[model samples]
Target: MAKDHYSVLGVQRTAKPDEIQRAYRKLARKYHPDVNREPDAADKFKEIGEAYNTLSDPETRARYDRFGSDYRHYASSGAGPGGNGGRWGPRAGARPGRGGYGNVEVDMGGDVDWEDLLGGWFRQQAGGPAQGTDHEAELWLTLEEAVRGGKRTVRLAQPDGATSNYVVDVPPGVLDGQRIRLAGQGGPGREGGPQGDLLLTMRIQPDSRYRLKGRDIYVDLPVTPSEAALGAKIKTQAPAGTVTITVPSSSSSGRRLRLRGQGMPNPRGLPGNLYAEIKIMVPPSLSKEERKLYEKIGSVSDFNPREER
Candidate 1:
């Protein structure tokens, strides 16, 4: 008995064209002989191709819907939906003795070209070896790692309960959501064709010290109350390293000091800038000398912060 084409493709009889195509692609990728070494994989792949070929075409699908598995026989014999001797006949302009059913021409004696029938990737596969499908994965990295590009080892979990490790070369200044393509590292090709690429999307891990917005880097610059009142040179940590920046005199909290080109580096264009946001800090408890000095300053100075506000 012939197998149901819709069942073979794992789709409903009423499945849409795009749905059928998607199912075919997924099953073909899973059971392709080059990818799946199981004994039944090749047979399964061929069955999927045949099902797709029969159902992908609108005319063929209509006939299949009407005639089920025997659609081919009915198509070639000019039989109606009922049986072999049903009342369906050739169309008005169909050539006689051509085995025509409606407008479709049935080829009686030629070898079927599954490649042409299947189309898309199968067409390429029929010509020769077929390139494998590309694969995508997320690769999480620290902000420091993104800033300093280098080789790092990554482990990917496979479908068969195993893991594959790869040493990936990360590019400098790689931003969050950026994809890096590793050539010939994706799904294996069929019949010795070239392998596809493995695309790794960069996911920068959250850091307490640094926050990123586009190419710009923002870091909190903590300053003492004295430093904010009477400008001072402070050493703060940056992605590159520790750097000394002089705070402007009378600098207040929430002030932003921009460091040009000290942010994320851009290989193609201008590098991003780093913004240092000032955050004032004070001692939890003041010493006796500090209290005396504060009392004296309170008596001498007329700086009322509330009045200014």
Candidate 2:
């Protein structure tokens, strides 16, 4: 058997409409699954919704008072509330999945009214807009996206069994772990409150070619043995674009050449620097001509690469 509407709402059988509303709001705020961690909170909130929806309507309340939940079924199904006919469900707000109060926090969007004054002054609900707990989600960005500052779309699966695609603007110089807010996109609120904002924590995806620290970026600058030893101007990829860098004469692998203001653009202050670390690469397979050239250099030059400085 369904619980009595009055008992479910913790209200007197003679409770006034406002009183019932206040009580329902209070319970909804207390038991809403978005804010409350209790296993049965969703069920409790749903029960409160059912009670409020039934008792708030004059016709339903009168019919319920005269008969019972059995009569409620008949009334909802086009029959009078006095007879037991068909079992029926409550209105939208009563069902957790049906009305959308499970995973969203809603603030009373417009101006305060009698409901607000009554809810606040009586402490039936908090003084501020009735809201649910804050929620968090992860947002992954590429190094290019983070440095360049642009927009990206992300798919989010919410707690109340809802999935959505949200577009977010990525600000220039956004750092990892930074949070972006999408207003009114979080858990549902009690009654007619506005939804809470969804917070996204930015994460820069790992790239083999680039390593980022704060605003600075590091990248590998590959050069041949001939180029490193004799010095040359070679082009390499940077956060912003490709740039030519001059290698010092007799340069070795692991040497870093700095590029100012080329790492990441700063929206408020000085931009980060880019470092191009030199890596000497050798050909995996050498032809007869290359091997003959290497043998010629080895035979002529007495340079010992392993000798300590």
Candidate 3:
């Protein structure tokens, strides 16, 4: 049997939100695919990511808890109460051709967000007859979701007295602010003009363990004071899971370790580095004897941080 996500992260079933996040970060750093190079590391990272995505959000988590993994099937099939599966609009009709593909349809209400629906229309009008207006929207993803791309259904209100739902594929390496185009998904063709396109931008959900800067990823890792004093290979975590990094002895807090080509990959096919910022931590609840020992050894070195200034 597959390990439970909660178990993989080493958290209790009732762990608080922050606790769950902390656990995930710690584990992610330890097993990240780039760092470990393990055969199944990528798959493990993806599994944890899916679990976190489902459990992290209140609404989505509630649905999952109520209906389990199969809840999505129920949601899409309009199997839930209230006729329309509590969706924004109507269920899709038959798919087109063969085994029923491209046959799904949605009826968006007339009072739908005009800007969302007609932004492309106005933009097209600006340039002569305008090629079909292109639609744009943001897609929020978790770290794991980005690694293992899949389909997502989003609901939109229409100009008619109805709603419309679209199934979109979230491809891998789709970074934040990146756009995915759906051909001919724009406003109706004007006077025999070709249909426009729909542009969907991506925004990954924030993770407490990982921070992205452009294509590079940064993470703060905790290290013991002793480990910093006596350089060691410290295991750390990332969105892809965990990896071990060498920490030269005599390292200090705020030191950075680099993992080449481990950061986000861009459209140009260039991958960025992964930076691990070290934060040395002391025991918060030290006993009196431990404090005395520290004081005895305090004056061993003369290091001044502000000397450079």
Best by lDDT: 1
Q: What is the TM-score of each candidate against the true structure?
A: 0.63, 0.59, 0.51
lDDT (Cα, tens digit) per residue for candidate 2, span 1-309: 789989988889989888987786677657756567888776776777667766875545755775687654443322333423222233223337544234343343333343333324322212234564345566788888888888888775343424578889989889899999998886675446677687888988999999998788999998998999899999877767788899998888999998888887888899999989999999999999999998999999989979986
Worst 10 residues of 2 by lDDT: 83-92
lDDT of 1: 0.74
User: Which residue pairs clash within candidate 1?
Assistant: none
Residue runs of model 1 more than 4 Å from their true location after superposition: 1-127
Better of 1 and 3 by lDDT: 1
Better of 2 and 3 by lDDT: 2
In order, the Cα lDDT scores of the candidates are 0.74, 0.71, 0.63
Q: Give the winner by TM-score: 2 or 3.
A: 2
- Cα lDDT tens digits, model 3, 66-98, are 556555554333234422323332223223453
The count of backbone overlaps in candidate 1 is: 0
lDDT of 1 by residue, 1-309 (tens): 978888888888779988997887787668766567898876777787678767765555766776678777653323443232344433322444543344554433334443234334422323446576565567889888988789988776443324578889998899999999989987667568888787888999999999998889999999987899889999999987887888998888899999999898888899898899999987899999998987897899888777856
